[model samples]
Target: MSVTAAEVLIDTLHDWGVDRIFGMPGDGINGIMEALRFRQDRIQFIQVRHEEAAAFMACAHAKYTGQLGVCLATSGPGGLHLLNGLYDAKLDGQPVLAITGMPFHDLIGTKTQQDVELDKVFMDVAVYNERVMGAAHIENIAHLACRTALSYRGVAHITFPVDLQDSEVSKPTTKRNVPNHTSDVFAIEAGFPSNRDLDLAAAVLNGGEKVVILAGRGALGASEELELLAERLGAPIVKALLGKGSVPDDSPYTTGTIGLLGTKPSQEVLEECDTLLIAGSSFPYIEFLPKPGQARGVQIDMDPMRIGLRYPIEVGLVGQCRKTLNALLPMVQQKEDRSFLEKTQKGMKVWWALMEARGTNQSTPMKPQVVAWELGKQLRNSAIVSSDSGTIATWWARQVPAKADQLHSVSGNLASMANGLPYAMAAQLAYPDRQCVAFVGDGGFSMLMAELATCVKYQLPVKVIIIKNNTLGMIKWEQMVFLGNPEYGCELHPINFALFAEACGAKGLTIDDPQHCAATLQEAFETPGPVIIEALVDPFEPPMPPKVTLDQAAKFAHSLAKGEPNRDKIALTVLSDKVRELI
Candidate 1:
């Protein structure tokens, strides 16, 4: 009997070294789902509750492993649910392949049920988007999608009609697999910048007196080279959020994250630097970057389009991050004056002191900063931490100290909520032996709370720490800063997250008192199965920016006058802390 196209597609995926796929079964995808069942030993199918979680899991899998992550969904709404997670993959530059099953080819355009245009929907997010029209095209299309996703480091999508999936084909024509199991169609090499471009970049670095290095996700592979570059240039390094683990937070020359979710020391470094060296990061926030004419910049990126995109660049060197940095290091002159680096390091120490004071607060409703600080301290060097976006991100970015060997991931460019749980689930699935933890806010976690069952079903043993403030903490802060409005519609009715976890067959604990915060977290970490620690944090504790501008103060004051809850307590404590610095 001739093999079906669906079987051939699965075979191609297996040949390309794909171990697992995340998705749900549906009528539209029954053929492919059955094929997956038949090939259970070769490839595992992780059934998620929602298609969104499936895509999120796949995106996280790609991010954690640096390989092509695959996800599947049925037609119409199922495929639509994948947009947000697929967008996350696209923006973060992760290689992910999304396979969606569409309606029968004949009924696609007849206003049939579940007949959405998959190609049109996925075109923007995918580097390669195609629909398999014939049975023979399955292997070729599958191979191309995988290759495109891996080589380009972005999303590739293939939509298969349900009827065509089971269509039989004889002797599918494709390239022969080599002895090493790599396909001839997918072999590629890394590209680097020209020698002239490297020399120019080195010259720019050597000529500047106050140099600051901005590292991004692209620098993850070149930690040693990055350290050497910073040492030689006497430069202070400020990491972008995605670059959290690119360098150890304990490094003398390293300042914390720089942006809205950044530290004062990093902001200071950005303000004072005369020359900026950006490696492997295209952080989109221009407001956080130096103004025009503030600094001469040299950007190192593999994509020429992203170089000098956020800042004005004097030199843009297009090359692989590790290779480019290695080449530039030898040509660059070592700085004689280490004053700037020393000053930044001193400022970093003061910032750490301030954070320590905040993290140890003994307020009635526990401060969220303490959770991040305690968790960071307790995390092993081999631990993998996934943080959700919003107010929770501020704590992780500021308080959590990431080591070189440890891994950290957040929703970077997309900055979407509800990713923490899925990210943690995928990380745990990928590295079952490693300690995995997720820091998620109440609002964000509620968005995908159903996935808790996904964790328990697999017995992933992922530790979930929910900062339950019963409010959209980040949005409330934003309203105060931008609209001068008392937070409206941001409040959430408190739910017993601990009880919810227990209902899902997981151990749950609640830490409302500051005294037991540390002990409770330690217990949760030690639990053998999936655990959820619901820390009822103080909602009034705002995620203040590194520098509070005059306009921000005015808006905050207006918000207070408009009867923001806990105004007196928040103003007296947080505002007073800011005022003491002025004195």
Candidate 2:
């Protein structure tokens, strides 16, 4: 049988170390599907309900595994569905490849049926994007796409015309006109920073009495060294959401996550610190960081572009972070004064205590924090967790204790909804033995609820927890706090998610009563197959900030006065939660 271009493309991907792909099939991409079927033993094909979920799975697979994640979709609408998830990968800097089918070559640009110009569509999301001209073009572009995706730490897209996909042609090579990256898979290794730059960073870190370290996704795999650095400098670490695994919450050094989904200790430390050492985090929100020139800054990043972009740094060290930290440890001086560390640790104690109280309290409608806190309390230390965006994200950030062995991530830069379940599914596939949990809001989960079938079919055994507040809780709060507007168009019609899960041939559990919350979560997590735990939580409970600004307070009050829905309930819930901390 003559070899097709699609087969050749799959072969190249196999050679590049791709083990599996996530996507659904369509008529436009039947050629690629046949190729995947032909070599089913070599590569696993994970079928999903939506192209968007497939893209999310791929992006998250890359994030959790550090491998090139690939998603396949058909042309036109299928291709269009991939943009949101692809954007998540691009913004969060995950290495992903999105392959889509296009209309026949002759039919393209005629505005023929399903003739969406995919090349133009992918321009913004991909670091490397190209369409295969013919069979001969497959091997070269496949190699280039995977290489570029890994190198840039971003998205790559390849569109193949349906007609040329099944055509037979000889491989083209050794021609001068052929592009340069035609060789086998090659690695671009990162080196350590120069001795001078390391010394400069160490000097700034050691000179300050009140120093704080901020770690992001790039700082993974340096837990021990980072802790040592923290001890040496008496600094507490504020982890960005993606880097939650960088340091253990069990350690005295961690102040939890930053930004709105952040801790009071992190807020206080950033506000009062005299020197800052940022590692691998371009944690936006400069307002939350130390004021410029109020503190000396040092940064460590592999990407030179990200090092000094978020903050003004006196010293920027670019290199492999673990190697960089090891080299600089010797140069840094240990501080005998542990006053700052003591104070930070004290604040963390109170924060945890407050979180525990909220988790244990019995409410008419379950509190969102109770769901996250109960889940975290029961999950295995090695378990992985994915948090979807919203007030649920806030609860997850505050209540979940990120152990060093646990992996946690969300749509970091993009902050997109519906990523939690997809990310958890990817995690379950990656670590079949270890449990994976998706802490998702009702609004986010409803957006991609069909993927529950993906979990059942694949037998992924992921534990999905839905905080069912029946509202777009985050947007309602944002409208109140940021715009001083009454909540409008934020409510969602309730769905019985537990019943939906049962209908999908998976285990389902419901916990509307706080009294049985822990037992229900334990039952859901302990079930053998895929399970969804739907907890009906209070929509009125606010995601209270660590520090409320006068402007924010004014805006929130104005919103309530302007007849925000359930304003009295909102005020009482907010006040009670805040008051719990002092007690």
Candidate 3:
């Protein structure tokens, strides 16, 4: 049987256990699309509304499933569209393979339609990028792309020229047809740090009176070890937003997330800690971390580059979180002083109380935190919750009381908007039995609302909660806080997202009144197919920082005095918080 390059590549992926590929089709990928049709039984092709959504879905697939995520796109413009989402994967460290088509090999430098230099275009976002020469080149490129992406936990790209897609392999014929050069078998072992290195880390952790452990996305599978380490060391575990699921919110020791969209207790603990043990986290906010020399540090990470990248750590233990911690446990000594842990625990109680007060507040325009808080209550134990970048992220970070079994993620480093829907869709696809929710702001939802049809088409039961504030809420507040400028160009024209969802043939529900927030969210979660819950939360609800600085206070005052719009509402909202005791 004479096999075309496209078929060869597709078949190889199927052997590698690739069940699906997210993409939208076009003429440039005609041969590849035909190849997919032949192998559709083995590898399902998920059609997305946009190429950007395809890449985002691929990234989310990897995050949720712990497998290789693959997205396909046509030549030129379609490939360009995938860049934003691919960069999201690159920045957040997900394994993804992006296959893009080129116009034709001979069409190069001819300025033909969709004649893109795609390999070069993807160089910045992809760790391993190469262009396929012909049918004989398929195995080499496909194997390398898949392997590199998994090994590096980053993006890999392969560009196949339209002309060569259907070409049958020619006999070696003096060409460099290096055959059987690779195999599908690849494994990333949970390596162990040397006993000597573990001793060094244990000594650092044991010596300090007040120790703090910051867990990031890298710490996802090390929860048992983490709880044990914290118990022995008498340290409180503070999670970064990406690491929210490392230890559930109900775990007495976790001080929640720490940054702008963080808890006050997390901030206080980080500032006061005498020793810091970083477990698979590279939290970027240097200001919120302990002053460089104040806290002696010990960090555990698989990537040595990230171990001491954020803090001046004396010990850098390079290994997987669970494995490294397992090895280090024996050498670690119990710390008798429980004062710091007790203080942080007490602080957590006050923080949650404040969060509860903020979350339950009912007003004409419903509180946004109420939606997140109630959504937290409604989420299935085995659910996946995704948030977009904006004030919605703040609510998700602070209000979503996580269960140990639930998975929570946001667009971490890239902080991209319009990612919630795609992320939820991918999560739903990955695990159809478990629930998936998208917590999106109005501005963010508006950008990718068309994916509502994609959800319906795929029969993915994703609950989308749209915080319907008629403004670009985060940027508007940023203008007031950082620049001390009056809010301008932030207002969004109203769109009844629920009505739009109904029009899209999906279930549509709305909660304009505060009284109906809980019941409406419950209904949304319980509904059968894709449901969009338009929650009319207060646009004036401020996205406050974990701790306010004097400069920030002055800037906010200057903005208000200079006639920031909705000044009266802002004043009432600011003055109304009675949860002021802890700070």
lDDT of 3 by residue, 1-583 (tens): 8888999889878877799999989888888999999989899999988999899999999998889999999999999999888999998999999999998898976999988899998989999999987678888779888988898899999998998998987554345566776776665654578888888888888898889999998899889999998999889999998899999899878999999999999999888999999998888888899998999999988777787899999998888988888888888898888888999899998889888877787766778988888888888899899999999999999999879899888888889999999999999988989999999999998888899999999899999999989999999989999989889999999998888999999999999887888888888877899999998878888899989989888888889999997998887877765343334
Global local distance difference test of model 3: 0.89
Descending-TM-score candidate ranking: 3, 2, 1
Model 3 CA lDDT for position 234: 88
lDDT by residue (351-388, candidate 2, tens digit) is 88888998888877788888788888898989989999
> How many residue pairs collide in each prediction?
0, 0, 0
Q: Which parts of model 1 are misplaced by more than 4 Å?
A: 171-184, 576-583
User: Which residue ranges in model 3 land beyond 4 Å of their true spot?
Assistant: 173-176, 578-583
Against the unseen true structure, what C-alpha lDDT does each candidate score? 0.90, 0.90, 0.89
Q: Estimate, for each residue in 1-583, the C-alpha lDDT of model 1 and write its tens digit.
A: 7889999899999988899999988888988998999999999999999998998999999999988899999999999999999999999999999999999999999999998989889989999999988788887778888998988889999999999999987754455632234353754445778888888888889989999999999888788988899999999999999999889999887998998889998998899889999999999988988888999999988778898889999999877888889888899888889999999989988999888877776767788988888898889899999999999999999988998789999999999999999999999999999999989999999999999999999999999999998899899899988789888889999889999999999999999888888899899988988999999987788899999899998999999899988689778867665664444
Worst 10 residues of 2 by lDDT: 171-180
Clashes of 2: 0
lDDT of 1: 0.90
lDDT of 1 at 103: 96
